[model samples]
Target chain A: MLKPDLLIVGAGPAGMSAAVVAARAGLSVMVVDEQPTPGGQIWRGIEANAGTARGRALGAPYLSGLATVRAFRESGAVYWPSTRVWQIEPTLRTYVTGPDGTLMIQPSAILIATGAQERPAPFRGWTLPGVMTVGAAQILLKAPGTVPAAPVWIAGCGPLALLYAHQLVRLGGAVAGFLDTRMPAPLAGAARLAAGAVLRSGRELAKGAYWYADLHRRAGRYVRGVVDLQALGTDRVEGVRYRTADGRVEEVETSLLLIHEGVVPELHTARSLGCQTRWHAGQAAYVPVLNEWGESSVPGILVAGDAAGIGGAEAAIQRGRLAALRILSRLGRLPAGQEGAEAACRKALARALAPRAFLDRIFMPRENVFLPDDDTIVCRCEELRVRDLRGALSCSVGANQLKAFTRAGMGPCQGRQCAYTVASLIANVEARPMGDVEPFRVRPPLKPVRLCDVASLAEEAAPP
Target chain B: MFRLLEQGRSGEDAVTIDLDGQPVRARAGETVASVLMREAEAWCRATPVSQARRAPYCMMGVCFDCLMLVEGEGLLRACQTYVRDGMKIRRQIGARHVVPSC
Candidate 1:
């Protein structure tokens, strides 16, 4: 059981940044990631796939991770790649299953930068074979250079969806149509926020504008103000049907349907560790409550990156550096006075996060996406539909009790895919704040662990 | 079904694996779901109750729809598992094992 001063859970932009900063400051750091590489989903396979034509087609934001990853590799941090952290105890003991076997480590401080996940927006026929998330499509392209067969249709509203469409077109993949669900109503503060973004982070604004312009020019069948969207198929997706704001229903033929409604913090690991979270209205998700320096309600356990909230990769990196500096200061490793540096970091983080409110306003997912029809399957693991959940809701408002009755969130995923949708539906039906609906209590083995592996743990235990 | 862009591919070593008793070729670093999709095998597993077909929807391991039976491994996620030489895999039919009476 080798212990380190700081144990970082992810090797994304945030975790990698923290490792580099802390290790450079003479603090021992250990970073663990499930992927074989350091880059989280955003920069996945960056080392192996970055130089390819498809990678270049992904644009500047995707390529920007190369320098961060290179710095982390040279920081002399102990990186455990292809490792899965199954449980985190309050005593700072983290249990992980890696290439060797099950092992545990005790770190003085823990930082969870596990990152974000695409929000689960269930709709009719979503379980069909050819239906997948836009993030998933991006993953295939980023990792393996694979593209869905021709006649692919993308749906939903978010920057990621548009980015994926732009990348796909750049890669010579055909997009049959794109259904944008953003309502046309003007956002109250969008203009002011956009201006602030341009003033503060001109490079990011310009990059985003470039992507938007490229997508607009390449994608021909782009429709806005879409509603009542549904994938049409029995065994596999064959087409998509949606109603436009102009009050006309249209169906487009397609073999693959990619959907996205933005992303939310992946909260199972944070919640399982008993970190207090607050419902964020802007992102419509529950974000872990963290102080200015990224420390959670529970001392010694910090959260950064999109896991802390919906901040993008750049903000994640800034937040990670800030957390590392605070840890160093708390450990008496910092010099007598470096307030200026600390203040500069804080200001940079603020600038990085300045544009999020405007983006959230523009890309907010429509209410109907989460509020599925009675027949639409809400829980993919248990195959529980909205009607089944509504039946459970009639008897109780608590998500845990509803789980007991209908087994909505009790499957292998442990509510990762359906918890948000279930919680939102319960809150809407019970006429209570979304926060009032309690999240499912996540237990050990956060990831699916084989029974054999668990049983063999005793043989590989480190001697005291 | 999907295919990789010729110029974007890594040119990784190719390996052959058994898929439902048939030999299928896959790249060394490619996932089982990627190989399946390349071969036009859309349905990965079937639902327990109705035996309805399902495929890899998330492809990032969140969706359990891509569950498949690996030789000696019982059941594993096709999207999560990388392809290996001589690997034996089969489409997971409706519930293969039932819970015994308590």
Candidate 2:
């Protein structure tokens, strides 16, 4: 058993930020990350130590990850790279797989800074190899700086979808079209998004207006509504069938289809700890219920970042540090000043996430988050379609039940993309709350690496 | 949070803002965010994630809309660090995807 003063579960901005702060304050800190490097998914550090230009160019601002890596090395922070942490106990203990094998770890305090997973909305022929989430696409670029240039169509809602499209266009990838998952008129729900827009800095508003104007100017329209993805080639995507809001369907040929619809925090660990949770209507998922200090209702345990809710990395980083300060204070590692520090962090958290919160609510999944078309495939692996899912819904079955019937959410991506669509469709069809549908437990590798690579960690279950 | 000048706070070395294409003199005690916001490039990064008109929604790096392609670096969290002289800070709207995933 390895013991430390602080055991950080992720090495992303949140976990690393927490580790840096706490370690600087003189506590022994240990950070275990599944990836070979410390930056996690948002800031994937290049391994070969080559410092390739690939990461520098595409990753943009996160390139400064080198500095953070340097800091960790200097601080003597115990960073177990390539360590897949499978189980996080309620007592804030953890079991992880290191290079040699699985190991149990006990810490004085633990920070659950595990981040979020992108939501997957289904379309026809989406099961094809070339069709992947924007997150997955970004990872490809991050790891080896590889951007597939074969006519990509980025589809779905939220910032990520646009971000991917914008990047793809710049990187010589021919973007057949940029599809915003929301309706063009945006429905009445757009008012909420406009409200969120009100708080944005003037520059951003100007940029947005410019983009909108540019879209109207160039394409004579903005991209909106659902699209039917198809494999134009043998193994990859060849084109897409775009259906506008009024319901005009157009076939567009493409080599790749990058889809993303915001994201939800990875909540399995929180659930495993038996933490009280509430459904965030905006995020369309259940998140650990945390307090102002980022503390879970479960006394010693604290939560931060997307795990608490789908706040971005900046919010997660701040919350992680603040949570640490509070936990340290509570554990008697630090002096009084707990109240003041917590107050400050809370203020920062609110201000940082406020703008996004508004947008999140506006872009919140609707009753038809996945009004899957009649022939749209619901399960990518099994190639199950809406008809199959409808049968399950008619029977009043849930994601798990449907999985048993159709294997919709049990594929390699672990239903990361299909689960929500399935649950939402089920909920909408059944006229039940999303909470009733419940979330499927997430087991490791939270990220699906090669089976051979994950051999060591495979022994440890994520403890659903 | 403090990536832009108006949003920057005093006494904290949060961001490094370049002045007229030249890096300003920022000490460790002051936050790079504060100093960068004071510089001409106050509109450090764009906000797609945070929905902020300006970037650095969390000022901590979680809300990554404030990402900038700095000189000698690809992207850095402007709100998280203090300013440094001669530092090349470039704004990153988005970057071109390179290479292919194996």
Candidate 3:
């Protein structure tokens, strides 16, 4: 068994930033990530794409990750890429499986920076091939530098979807159409949010405006206030059907359909550790309850980045640095009166998150889209439909109870794909606040591992 | 369903991996999901529960929609697994068979 003074899960912007700080502070840091490379989803393949034309096309924000990744490599922190931490015991004994099978890690403190994932939304024919999230499409462009051969239709709303459509247009790729699903907010409320956005995040708002204009100019067709969206196909996605603002249904033929509402913090690792979480209504996801230092309710466990909330990469980096400072102070490695540095990080984090409320207000997912049609498959892994879940909800009151009654959240994904939808269904039926509806209890062996891998871990534990 | 961009396809070595009974070329750093998506028929596996054809939805490791079988391993996530030369890949048709460790 190997021991590190600080164990950081994920190698994203947050985790990487924290590792650099903690390791520089003389702590033995081990950063583990499931991806094959260092950059997480936001900066996937950043190292390879840094100086290339593709990176330039991705803009300055993406290339900024190269310096962070380079510093992390030279930080004296041990990074174990492709290592999946399936279990983190109550004793903070972490179990991971990688090239050498399973290994146990004992660490003094654990930081979870697992980051955010695209919110999984279910609709008619979503299970069909060729339908994927806008985030997935971005990964393809970033990693393999691939783009769809034919014109692809993009549906849904948010800065990400707009940004991706703009990126594809910049790449000289074809866009069949864009279906914007953002619901209209009240004029007074929207004006208040827009004023704040203009004042606090003018540059970010300018970038978003540029993307919107570019996509609108380039897209073959653009429709706003779209609802009742569904992929129409047999075996694979053949076309898209959506209801426009005027309640008129429109259909467009396309081989590919990319959808996105927004992202939610990935909570499997943190949840399994029994960290306290509360539902964020605007983001429509459960985020861990963390203190100012990024430490969770469970002492010694810290959460940073989007895992704590929907703060983007910039906020995540500052939060990571703040967490590292706190951990160093706890370890007695830092002298007192470091309040200046701490205050700086806090101010930067606040500035980075200033426009979040405005963005959330504008891009909040449509209420109708949250609850799928009865026939739609909500649980992708279990092939369970909304009707199936509704039948179970008659007897079940919460997510865990519904899982037992319908087996919706027991699949390989462990409810990552269906938890949001399942919780929504239960709340709608039980007539309770979404916060009151409990999510599935995340257990160890979070990712599926082979029996042989478990046996190898046991062998490693045995005395020689 | 996908093609590589000329500007971004910089100095990367290409390797051939066996898909079913046929050989397919893939870039050195590309994952199995990326390689598979290049095919016109991009479906990677059939769902174990419904035998419904499925393709990789999330290129990241979260969604298990891209589960495929390698030469010796049980089902592995295609999006997470990098493509290696001569690696025997097969679409998981149904439930994975129980592999005895004894």
Q: What's the true lDDT of residue A223 in model 2?
A: 71
Query: What is the per-residue lDDT of model 1 for residues A153-224, given as tens digits with 9 covering 90 to 100?
Result: 888888898788888888889777778888764755777877777787787667678867776677768887
Provide the lDDT at B23 for model 2.
49
Q: Which residue pairs show backbone clashes in model 1?
A: none
Question: Which 10-residue span in candidate 1 chain A carries the lowest summed lDDT?
Answer: A455-464
Cα deviation of B48, candidate 1, in Å: 1.8
TM-score of each: 0.95, 0.70, 0.97
* Stretches > 4 Å off in candidate 3: A335-337, B7-13, B100-102
| Cα shift from native, residue A368, model 1 (Å) | 0.8
Ranking of models by DockQ: 3, 1, 2
Chain A TM-score for predicted structure 3: 0.98
Put down candidate 3 lDDT per residue, B1-102, tens digits, no spaces: 788886334536468899988898888888999989889779988888989999999888888899998887768899999988898899989787777523
- Give the Cα error of residue A109 in candidate 2, in Å: 3.2
Please give the CA lDDT of all the candidate structures. Answer: 0.84, 0.61, 0.88
User: Which of the numbered candidates is closest to the native, going by highest lDDT?
Assistant: 3
Give iRMSD, candidate 3: 1.6
On residues A19-99, what C-alpha lDDT tens digit does candidate 3 reach at each position? 998998789999999988898898999988888888888888888999899999999999999999988988889999887
| The 10-residue segment with the lowest total lDDT in model 3 chain A | A333-342
